[model samples]
Target: MSVLSALGSINWIAVLLAVVAYSALGGVWFAVLFAKPYAASLGRESLPQPAQPALFFGGPAVATLFVVITTATLMAALNIDAAADAVVFALVVGVGYLAANTVIIAINPNMPRPLFYGLISGAYHLVGIVVTALIVVAF
Candidate 1:
């Protein structure tokens, strides 16, 4: 009946797996792949380290909470019953994320190169969509 209740009825394991997968994807991109180059481009010695000792170790925990809340709200509203449906839902959410990030980059001219930032950011959501889809299908 409530949105949280509707979401609670779904498989939490699947949701968590999707969140972890997406977070890992982002970590790899920001930490290993582009960290140095992006930081150099920004005229900084290093990428801004995330604030630690928060929830779920910090970044990943916050990211997981975001995904959970958004996905739960979506499932409640859309009444998703199948994995394929969840995939579509994730893709739609990805677009919203893309738009938001794009707007942020536009508003902040000092951000990284638009193309590079967009590509990396887009990959993050792509991971989220794929993982969410897989979770929905498998579980």
Candidate 2:
């Protein structure tokens, strides 16, 4: 079957829910838990204002949509229909790729406090992937 066809078999509502999960999780993670540290890491005294008005929603919306589509494609590729399978796939992708690379790149010579960035960024991706996977597979 074509990869697109595989995704066609998935419940679209599940895909959307997964996308929303990432944004919602990000809201809690950045705005509440790691707000101060994340801002400080960026050399900002507080959450920096976006230069453009569209950034508040547009940025995360596009990125999350991209991720959801990719995840659906991967699920189709792997024939992953169960939530447990989805979680395993997501963890592998999140930890092995996203979290690892963020740490490596963010800790470069010019960076300050790599640990804080690593902790916050890593948690965001890992948690996001887990939540997305579970929600996508469950419904």
Candidate 3:
């Protein structure tokens, strides 16, 4: 099926909920759970306030939306109505795409501790994707 057709099959409300759920996970993961390790991953003593706090927060929300949309589209296209299949799809996409990309993105000149950053951020995305899949399939 075409991309447009796949999009048409997606449940928008589920996508919205999944987006919100995934974005919220970012807060719990980065701010509350792994705050110290996250800071250290950046080679910092603590979390630095971004000059543009809006971008700091809003950027992830927007990215979360995109991720949910993509996952939802794929789910719809593949006719993944079952929870078990949804989870399998999530794991494959999460590990193969999101986590791998996170690690690759972490390996840069600005990242002093790339592997550490990857461990924290990649794990967050992995869990977030699973949450997203469950939410989407539930609806």
Q: Pick by lDDT: which candidate is best? A: 3
Better of 1 and 2 by lDDT: 2
lDDT of each: 0.64, 0.81, 0.90
Model 1 over residues 59-131: C-alpha lDDT tens digits? Answer: 7657665766567656765677677787777777767674456446734667646555565566666666657
- Clashing residue pairs in all predictions, respectively, total 0, 0, 0
Residues 42-117, candidate 2: write the lDDT tens digits. Answer: 6675556557577887798788888887777777777887978988999998898778877987897776777778
Cα deviation of 89, candidate 1, in Å: 1.8
TM-score of each: 0.66, 0.82, 0.93
Off by over 4 Å in 1: 1-4, 33-57, 102-106
Q: Could you arrange the candidates by lDDT from highest to lowest?
A: 3, 2, 1
Model 2: worst 10 consecutive residues (lDDT sum):
43-52
If both were scored by lDDT, which would come out higher, candidate 1 or candidate 3? 3
Scored against the true structure, residue 133 in model 1 reaches a CA lDDT of: 62
Looking at model 2, residue 107 earns an lDDT score of: 90
